[model samples]
Target: MATKKRKKISQAFTKSQLVKEISERCDLNKNQVTHVLDEMKDIIASHLKKNGPEKFTLPGILKIQVRNVDAKPSREGINPFTKEPTVYPAKAASRKVRVTPLKQLKEMA
Candidate 1:
């Protein structure tokens, strides 16, 4: 028996493509769609900056969170190439964004 190959799915969208699709669906101009998307980006950035490390939910779509990662302490290690002992310095704490899909959106998928 012969098996059929499955079609690959596209998992990414560019700003122009998103703007075009949303404009068509909403019956709005591309400029308006772009503005809305830009504004949404600005709002999310502002919230993340102001709130620091916390989850910010976007209703039924998804939740975004800022995470603060602690640095690793300095440690001694052997260099593989030179076979010499070296001390690795500690890393500074940093923040990052995390995203989680809402149940409603996950269910639709």
Candidate 2:
């Protein structure tokens, strides 16, 4: 049997990537983009919990927000590798994301 090689993606895309492109076009550094991303992540999480999923749009780049989700009880399954079945009884909340494609970005690709 042959094994397929894995490709590694950087934690943050290269300086020439889309996100970095936006950062540069907006006159911000890559680190600034990372900082904004981190802060926005926490803000979205809090908004989802407190006020429910609220839609936040970034105009042209991307829209970030949360949507209301239900917690569901699920069944357990066995780990094929170990052959041990484990049940998780706790209910889990489902989170989802929606990305609005932009015309410029679509053309860029």
Candidate 3:
């Protein structure tokens, strides 16, 4: 058995390049590929929205979850570098998206 050698990509693929590659491999037109990508964006957005499920999973690729973070009050903390007391501003509570790559995606890396 022989394995194929793939080129090492130095940088991330641009959207155009990604669309082209997906279109080629999937035997779909570029326009269709673009539309599918756009739809996926909408699906993810709606699933992760405030009133939605707060979780979106692309099976075999990754899982996306929303996490609620609590607000932090302003406090004095010691600066490690300067060895001085400094006041850190309070941070507002917010929701954050957490994306975790699954087994298949991790294996690809």
Predicted model with the maximum TM-score: 3
Query: Which residue pairs collide in model 2, if any?
Result: none
Instruction: State model 1's lDDT.
Output: 0.82
**Per-residue lDDT of 1-109 in model 1, one digit per residue for the tens?**
3334534548776878778767776778999998998999888887788454366689999999988898889999999999999998999889878899999999988
lDDT of 2: 0.67
Best candidate per lDDT, number? 3
Worst ten in a row by lDDT for model 1: 1-10
lDDT score, candidate 3, position 23: 73
Q: For all the candidates, what are their Cα RMSDs to the real structure? A: 8.0, 11.6, 3.8
Ranking of all predicted structures according to lDDT, beginning with the best and ending with the worst: 3, 1, 2
Cα-based lDDT at residue 87, candidate 2: 79
> Could you give candidate 3's per-residue lDDT for residues 43-106 as a string of tens digits?
9999999999999999999999999999999999999999999999999999999999999999
Per-candidate Cα lDDT values, in order, are 0.82, 0.67, 0.93
lDDT of 3 at 91: 100
| Least accurate 10 contiguous residues by lDDT in model 2 | 1-10
- Residue runs of model 3 more than 4 Å from their true location after superposition: 1-11, 81-83
Is 1 or 2 the stronger prediction by TM-score? 1
TM-score per prediction, in order, is 0.72, 0.39, 0.81
Model 1 stretches with alpha carbons more than 4 Å out: 1-11, 50-54, 77-86
lDDT tens digits by residue: candidate 2, 2-107: 3345345567666357567656567778888878878977876675564655666655666665554789777798978889997767677876666666666667
TM-score: model 2 vs. ground truth:
0.39
Q: How accurate locally is residue 72 in candidate 3, as Cα lDDT from 0 to 100?
A: 93
